[model samples]
Each structure stands twice: as structure tokens, then as C-alpha cells.
Target: MTAIRDDGSERDRVLANGAVMAAGTVVSRMSGFVRSTLLAAALGAQLHADVFNIANTIPNMLYILLAGGIFNAVLVPQLVRAMRNDPDGGDAYTSRVITLAALFLAVVSVLLVLAAPWVMELLLDSRFSEPALAAQRDSAIDFARYCLPQVFFYGMFVLVGQVLNARGRFGPMMWAPIANNVISVAVLALYLVVFGPAQDVFGAFSADEELLLGLGSTLGIAAQFVILVPYLRSAGFRYRPRFDFRGTGLGHTLRLGVWTVLFVIVNQVAYTVVVRLASSGTASSADGTGYSIYSSTFLIVMVPHSVVTVSLATAILPRLSARAAEDDLPGLSRSLTDTLRSALAVVLPFALLLPVIATDLANVVWGHGAAAAHYELYAPSLALFGAGLAFFTVHYLMLRGFYALERTRTVFWIQCAVGGTNIVAALVLVRATDAEHTSPALVLAYSASYLVGAVISYAVLHRLVGGLRTARLVRFLVRAAIAAGLSTAAAAGTAYLLHRAAGDPHWVVAAVWVVVTTCVDVAVFVALARVLRLGEVTTVVDTILRRVRPRHVPS
Candidate 1:
């Protein structure tokens, strides 16, 4: 198993990594669809939104802090160095680090559980004024308690998973999330079916609905943990219960990890603040239904965001680390630029299409409910928020570079600056908006924050790389915008035609629109790329399809 290099022709690496990551992500995202659908059906939008928003925030933050934020940034580079410097002790170092991370995260999980009440109070903001609403907040906190523990399991899983990835055993790490989603969907279904009509188990109707959902979902978390053990074992790794601090490489990781945690805390706190602003409800109602609406909408938009972020981050970070170690600055620069272009190309259609079909997608996936209004509010956000995916992907890759050079503090402060801007923007937007509406204002604020941050990130990268081929990048963006416009029109037309012909069955309409939009988007982009002599676009698409195509398959 030869290690994949992130040198020269970085566009090729980006395309190859994007394809694999996208395929796996598609499966995991499908599972998310199933999970969200089930929860919506079982508990309606308000309850489902409440649970999803809070419960996810816990692990979401943990994931950023550990696996995504710190672990990849810190763990991979350290492990790679260990493997290079002391080949014989590679396994021992891996084992000790895995043990320490697990123990540390386990303690963190306990602390989070203990502090759930306070965390919930902060996130829910004005949403929980009434006694019933307060109870719902407690229910959310309990659910958070259940979901938070999985961070420990997943954190350890990623530590070992990265080792496998470092060894060129990429398949298992890529597919693990699919298995986790499967377990989640299965458990949610089982709980709903078995406990749905039982008043004692589903406390939504009984005095204990909150506890049941909390405990039941925790069982789902345990299932997710169980699924990863075999994958870990197969990767020639095992988690032993030990915490060693002597020459275990914790120092290198800790410096980065602490900053990474702050970065994540700032990032998530901004998100939570947005949710809080929206949840604070309109000044007129005081019921906080606005928060519910925003929460529901955010979940739908996040599907594409998650898919894009995970796809690129998982594949690019390790390779970026290796590139930095060799001081291959040009290779690193090319890789980052190519990845940005390709990621933008890939995500643009979704960014356009989602807003066009937001109504149908929301109704189909979540059903007609109080969430319908929320969906509409969240629709434009899909495009605005989705466009940021490429920028965020670049930011993720750049942070990895920072870590590869062991510049943890730089990564930390950069994140804080970006995240702080978002928080302040959200607060100011909500404060300045008319008392009657705040959700859209907050969403706009978020989008604006990303825009500003992305510009800063690009400027920093420019200084670091001694400048990129701005002319080429500008041309690509122009071409991509044209492609997106054509695709958006195609999606809108297809959606309208399908609705008129089929009388708008949500599921069928969504399916047809997805197909039509995807085909048109790809076709138009390819044509524009060729017409404009954008070789990178053609080169990337050709390389990706070539690599993935079966021997028996035609070119």
C-alpha cells in the first residue's frame, strides 16, 4: 500500500479524493435523510426540531473539538512523524494515544452531561418561558446527555481510524459513518415502533416522554459505538484502558488540541447564538416558534454542508500534512487551489438547486407541518450557506496546513476571529431587525459572516503562497456562475413541469428535480469548461471518472 502523495497535479488528487469521499458521504447522508424523516414523522417538526437542534449541537461540537478540529489537525501529523522517526514504536505510540484520547474525551462527556442544564438554558434562550417549554428544554438536555457520550466513542474511533488512514487503509475509515447512520436509523425506527403507542416509553404523551426519547436515543449512540469496534479491530488496532503521558506524543497534540477546542467552541457558540436568536422568537409572539422554524430549516441546509465538508476534510488533511512535512510549498499551494475550484464546481449546483426546490424538498422530506414556514425561511439560506461550502473546504485544508507546520496557535486565533465575527454579526442583526422577524436576518448575518471570513482566508492563503493564479481562478468562478445559472433555470423548469404533470407528489417531484438538475448542471458545466478552455475542470472530471470507473466499464 503506497502512500498517496499530495504533490503536483493537486487537481487530480482533489478529484480522486472528492469522488470517494462523496460516494461514502452520499450513503451516510441518505441515512441522515432516513433519520430526519423518521423523527419528523414520529414527533412533528417542533419537537423534532427541538431535539435535533440541541442533541446534535453536543456531538457536533465534540466532533469539531476532537475528530474534526483537533484530532485530524494534530493526530495525523504527529502519528506520521512517529512512524517516520521510530517505525518499531509506531504501534505502541498509536495504542497509547488512542487510550489517552478515549479517557480524556470520556471525562469530557461526563462533564458535558453534568452541565447539560446550563448548556440547554443558553441555547434555548427565549424559547423556554412556559413550564411546558421548560420541560421540553430539559428533555433536550437529557437527549444531549445521551448524544454527548458518543463523542467519546467517536473520538477514540477517529484516533484509531486516522492510523488506518495513515497506513493507506482508507476504505474502512470512509465507510464507518455509513454504518453509524445505519445503526441510527434502525434504532430510531425500532424505538418508534416498539415505544410509539406505549405511553410509558414515549413520554411525549406520558410524563416520561422526554426520558424515554433521551434514554432510547442513548441506546442508539451505543449501537453506533458497537458498529465501529469491528472496524477498529480489523484495522489492527485495539483500545486498551490506559492513559500514559510519557513520550506518548500528547504534548504536540495538546498544544494544538487546546486551540482547536477553543476554535470549535467559538464556532459552535456562534451557531448556537444564531439558533438562540431565532429561538428567542418574534417580539410579538414570545412563543419562540421562530427558533423552531430556524432550527428546522438549518437542518435541511446542513445536509449539503456536511456532505461537502466531510468529503474534502477527511481526504485532504492527511495528505496536506505529508506535503507540509516535505516542505513542498508549490505542491501544497496547487493542492489547495485545485481543491477549492473542484469543490466549488461540485457544490454550486446544490447551492442553486436547493433554493429552487426548497419547498418541495422540505415538504417531501419533513412533511407539511409548522416546519413549512421554517423551510421557506431556510430555503434561500441553502444557496447562500451552500456557496460557503467551497470556502469552508479551503479553510479546512488551510488549517490542516497550519497544523502540518505545527502552527496550532495560528489556526486557533484565525478560527476565533472568524467565529467572533459571526457571533457579533448575528447578535447585531437580531437586535437591529424589526421585532416581528429575526430568523431571516440572522441567516443573512451568518451568510455575510462567511463571506467576510472567506475573503480573509483567501487573503491569508495568498500571502502564504506568494500569490495564486488569480486570473485562472477568476475565470473558473465566472464560468461556474454561468453553469449555476443554467442549472438553476433547469431545476426550476423541471420542478414546475413535474409538479404540473404529476400534481406535485412531493417525493416524485423531488426525485425528478434532482435528476434533471444534476444532469443539466454537469452538462452545462462541462460544456462551459470546454468552451472556455478551462483545462483544470476537464482534467479533474476526467481523472475522477477514470479512477472510479470499473475495468469492464466504458470511458
Candidate 2:
């Protein structure tokens, strides 16, 4: 991995970090393949949806407690400063923070477990009205209860991951999530074999399949936390379970944590509401199935999105934290700009083209199901949603910037505006649509609103920073769009023809078409980027190829 420079542009650091982040992300994503595929096959779409819905909710809630407001945005940056200034003293401080965080997460997890039923009913009341739906709700509640303690582990990972990130030691840190996913998938596979699916596991006890799945999930969580201990040890950090927050910047971390909680809470509400909207009109079991389908499809889409976002944020944050610690504005600004451009370059085509091939790709990877329509609904949204990642990432960077400066309120307000917009759009679009399915519409609205928010955020951020260099970005975007547009058109056409040729097995044929077309798209995208002099793409590829071929290996 390339070491990030304090003097380097944000773009350079983001690219370097993104590459590192991408490594972890790709592994995590591959592991997700194991997790999701097994989950899908074992649970099927309906139960899978419940598993994901509950699983997704757990992380969001945990982020609030662990990753929320100021901890990530503000407290972490402050901690990074202390560490840079005095590594020994800072380690002591971090140790305290870790202690405090674990306590907080443990208490919260217990409380949440106790309150799981009420919580589930409250969040998903709309879907649980029918008797069948009530059963699913009960299952989710039980599942959520068992999996709640994973929150502590989740918080530990983020807290530690941020610490690693600050030191520019990202490769192992990023891979931690892959470990988590791999563990989750393995546990799930074991559960399926021993129990013959979640329903069967619960069959003797009249246990809800959702609840049983949740039980299996916690086994995965154990893996998530266990793998990180070794990584932390390698980084020369050990967690002693002690709480000495007397003067360890606990006040600042808590203050930031409050806002982080608020922001995450709002986001979680919007997401759940949107899912509830999607489940409308279906029978309770169908609703369960619909939600599961959406969850699985969403997870599939998130593989790329998560990879990009996490990579960009993880790569850039530490460097930004370092610069912020030193109050280096010009260095920070330049770096921030570069990060945005690099993120855009990497994410643009996926954002644009995924919708075009969403269904084909979904059918290929997930196979067919009642919830297949859910995937179709989600695919277009994924494409459109890619537009906002850079903005969201920049928003995160800026928040981290502000947090480093002890500016918590700024992060809060921005999240409010953006999160509020997302909620409103989700509600209005989801409710307004008259189509049999509303989930896609809900996703589209949510995704498109982010696009709008990004534009606004970018404009405001640019004004704050004086100006951004747009000529190069504009040229690249235009050329890349044209290339992707043409490429997708070709891929779609080829898939259509192959579909006709394959007759009954159109999905199988479509799968082959996606691979072929994507290959073509990649070739065209690279060619276009090279011709347009988009240096980032070439730089990334060159680095990868160089790494792949050792100096002594004759290719």
C-alpha cells in the first residue's frame, strides 16, 4: 500500500486509500457473495428479507451508538490529533474511549433486546397488521433480540478501524469487514446444514424462522469481533477493559456521539419507512417475501456502493484527520477536491450502467423468485444512486473536517437537511406511486434525492472553498457517460438477442450476456478514459497490474 502524504492532494490520498479500501471492499463483497447467496438459498427470499431487514437495522442503530454523531465526525479527529502529538498519552486516552464505548454499547444492546418486540412493532407496524404479518414481526423481534449484542462488537470495529485509518494502516483494517462477512456466511452455511434451514431449526419449538436466523447471525457477529483483535494486536494496540474517562476527551466524544445518534436515527427511520411502504398491498407473507427480496437485492447493489463509499471515506478520513490536526486548509482543500474527483471517476460508470443491466445481473447472481420484481425495482435506483456517493463521501469528509475542528453542529445540520430530504422523498415517491410495487419507486426517490442533495452540497462546499477545477472533470464525465451509454446499449442488445436464442432459459443466457457486455463496457471505458487523458483510471490500472506481476515474474 502507498503511504499517504500530508502534502499530497486529497485526490491522491483518496485514490491511494480507495485502492486499499477497494481491496477490503472487494473481499468483503466476495464474502457477501457467500453470505447473501447462502442466506438466499437457505432462507429463500421471504426469510432472507426478514434476516436482512433486521440485520440492516442492527448496524444502523449500532452506528448511532458507536459510530454516531461526533465520535466518527468529531471525536475521532480529536483523538487522532492527540495520538499524533503524543502517541503514548493518546493511546491511554483511546483506551478510555474504548472502555466507555464498550460499556455504552453493552448497556444499549441489553436494553434493545428487552425492547425488541415493541421496537419491531413500532418500526414495522404497517406490515404486521395481519395475523401472518404479526408472526413475521414476532420472528423479527426475537431475531433482533439475539443479534443485539453484536452492537458492542460493531462499535469496537469502527472505533478501532478509525484508529488504524488515522495511522494510514488501512489494508488490514479494511479487510476486517471481509472477515466479518466470511464468518457470517460460514455460520449461516452451518446453520443451514445442521438445521435444514431456519424454519426447520425452529420447527420443534414452534420457533419463528426469523428468530432462528437471528440466532445464527450472532455467531457471525462473534467472528466479526474476534478477527479484529488480532489486527489490533498487530497494530500494537491492546484493549484492556478499563473505564478511566476522567479526562480522556470523553466529553467531546459524547457530545459528538449525540449528534451522530440523531443523524443515524433519522436515516434508519427513513429506510424502515421506505421498506414498509414497499410492502404495502401484499399479504403478510408476501410482505415478508417482498421485504426480503428488497433486502437481498439491496444488499447485492450495496456490494459496489459499500465498496466505493467505505474505501473513499476510509482512505481519505485519516489523512484529512492528520491535516485537520495541523489546521492545514490548503492541503486539506486540495486533498478533498482530488478525493471527490477520484471517487467520481471510479463510481460514475457503475452508477450509470447498473440500472441498464440491473435485472439481467440480478437474475444471473440471485436466480428467479417472487421477489424478482423487487430486484428490478431496485436496479434502476442503484444506477441513479451512484451519482450521490461522491457528495455523500465529501459530506463525510467535510463533517470529519468540521469534527476535527470541534464543529459538531455543522455536521448535524447538514445531515438534517440531507437526511430530511431523503425521508420526504422516500415518503412522497413511495406513497404517490400507484404501481403494484412501490419499493422501487421508494428507492428511486431516495436515491434521486441524494443526487439532488449532492449537487446542492457540492455547490455550497465549492463556494466555501472558493472554486473547484471543473474543466477536467466535465470532460471526463461527458466522455465517460457517452462511453457507458454506448456500452450499455450494446450489452442490453446482446442480452436481448441471447434471450431470444435461449428460449425458456432466458435468465441463464442473460447472465452470459452481462459478463460479455460488462467486459466490453470495461474495455470501452478504459479506452475512452485513456483517450480522454483521465489519468486516475490509468494510474489505478497500472498500479494494479504492476502489483499483480512481481518484478521477477515474467509475464
The CA lDDT of each predicted structure is: 0.63, 0.61
lDDT of residue 454 for candidate 2: 61
Task: List ranges where model 2 is wrong by over 4 Å.
Answer: 1-14, 65-67, 87-89, 191-212, 279-289, 368-406, 434-436, 470-472, 503-508, 553-555
Against the hidden reference, what TM-scores do the models get? Answer: 0.85, 0.87
> What tens digits encode model 1's per-residue C-alpha lDDT throughout 449-495?
66666776667767776665567789888877776777678667766
The prediction achieving the highest lDDT against the true structure is 1
lDDT of 2 by residue, 500-520 (tens): 766434556767777776777
Model 2 shows how many backbone clashes?
8
| lDDT for predicted candidate 1 compared with the true structure | 0.63
